[model samples]
Target: MTGVNIGILSIQGDVAENVSATRMAMDELGIEGVVSEVKNPEQISDLDGLVIPGGESTVIGTLSLVSGSLKKIKEKIASGMPVLGTCAGMILLSKKAKDRVVGEMEQPLLDHLDVKIERNAFGRQKDSFEADLSLEKIGISKFRGVFIRAPSVIDIGKDVEVLSRFNEKIVAIKQGNVIGTSFHPELTADLAVHKYFVTLVQKKN
Candidate 1:
């Protein structure tokens, strides 16, 4: 592929790790272009796809809103830019977020994915752990999912397809060009999810 530009939103999250994983995934596929930690609206427009890494949802939402990237991101997603949101990123992408540990406050949400998410669905930081996710529906054998104060998809709209589930709760979902996961795929060595996302980007391009 030529001139592929992917960005990992670095407002407040696991920015560097996602950048490294995305770059590695693109390199593995022999795709050449740029992988950057995007923090500004201008940088966002150059991106073919965006990755919102797992982090403190409240902080990420508020900071990005104040920085003016939140509105830009919402616009880009509306214009059909592919996006992958993991962990707290899922909260930002969700249409509604319930069960917030902290009291509800105004936070910028892209509302790209038609789902209701519950923040800290996997308990607190001490409850964080790794699990082998069976994403058979997405054609994956097993994915090592890292859950760090993750969010869970409590409800998904009819247009959304449940990609993977843990127990009875939907943990991964895809709707059109948007992908959202409750666990962190970048935290693991597997890059299938990221590669799958790139393919979506390529198709959209």
Candidate 2:
């Protein structure tokens, strides 16, 4: 498909990295598109797909909520606009989130992805690590995962499919057009996941 427009939630996190990866993914897939950093509801309404990059979940969610972008995103996702949420982005997309260190706390969340996420499931910032992950659902037999203060899926609805795992922990999951990852795909060089998302957007568009 041509003129596929994608956006990265730029309220917080790796906006530049996500933008670059998305552009690369679109180019690699030979899909003509514009990848922009969007933080307002108006900018979000035009997106074919969106990437909620890894960042501070609380801050991102709160800012989006205050700016009315969160509601707009939920509406788009409900309308079948493909969304890829990485790390903190995954937390915001979840129906429930509890930080392992502090348990559950009030936070604005999109609550569109039907899963309960355990924030900082691997420990704290110092515990961040990378590993080789096999995301067979995305046709990736082997992929490098960059986990930094990542969140893991502890509970999922019937529609949710576990895509990848590490140390017996759920790191990646998908429910229809919504994809969530506990690792940062943009931080890595692999384009498999991003390219797959681009194709998903193209298919939906």
Candidate 3:
């Protein structure tokens, strides 16, 4: 894992937290790597893996698009750059997104991940809550998932693997090396999910 470069899309959302979590995960795994904030296309191209943190999907997408980072991210992911998309980041990674209340959303998206997402599937910010999740795919069974205005995967491609669910709704999913979660694993104390993603980066690069 030496010299592996992992970047957190830092246009918005949990930039600092994701950076810290990824660094801690790398340390915990004894993997030598660089984790930093990435906002432009040049920085994105340098990443072996990426973390799109939880935040307003539209805002993040728009900001990235302004600097042409959106297209670069899609290209990287398409080229097998492992990415971890949490909460709104998950929605942005999907092929399509429909807001439960507003129906369709006209927002910029990476649209490389093969899934249809329902925005705000868990209600609004007021409905935010935390729960114990069983994420056996990532090796931790008793993971505490933090959800905040989370989106769910209502439809997925055949190759997509369901990692976890909440109230029978799809919450966490993995399509190849790309992982999308409706909850915020970076917001939790446990670093299992981040560690798992780091290992994937290690293997890929």
Per-residue C-alpha lDDT of model 1 across residues 1-205, encoded as one tens digit per residue? 4767899999887898899888888888877778889999999978899999988888998888888999899999989999999988888988888765764446678777998888888788899888898888778889998888888888778999999999997999999888899999988889999888877777787
Which candidate number has the best TM-score?
Answer: 2
Could you tally the backbone clashes for each prediction? 0, 0, 0
> Which scores higher on TM-score, 2 or 3?
2
Question: Candidate 3's C-alpha lDDT?
Answer: 0.91
TM-score comparison, 1 vs 2, better candidate: 2
Which prediction has the highest lDDT against the true structure?
Answer: 2
The Cα RMSD in angstroms, rounded to one decimal, for candidate 1 relative to the true structure is 1.6
Each model's lDDT = 0.86, 0.93, 0.91
Write one digit per residue (lDDT tens) for candidate 2, span 48-138: 9999998899999999999999999999999999999999989999999998989996899998888999999999889999999999977
Q: Give the TM-scores of the predictions, in the order they appear.
A: 0.95, 0.98, 0.97
* Model 3: pairs clashing at backbone N, Cα or C within 3 Å: none
Off by over 4 Å in 1: 100-105
Can you give the lDDT of residue 84 in candidate 3? 96
TM-score rank order:
2, 3, 1
Off by over 4 Å in 3: none
The per-prediction CA RMSD against the true structure, in angstroms, equals 1.6, 1.1, 1.2
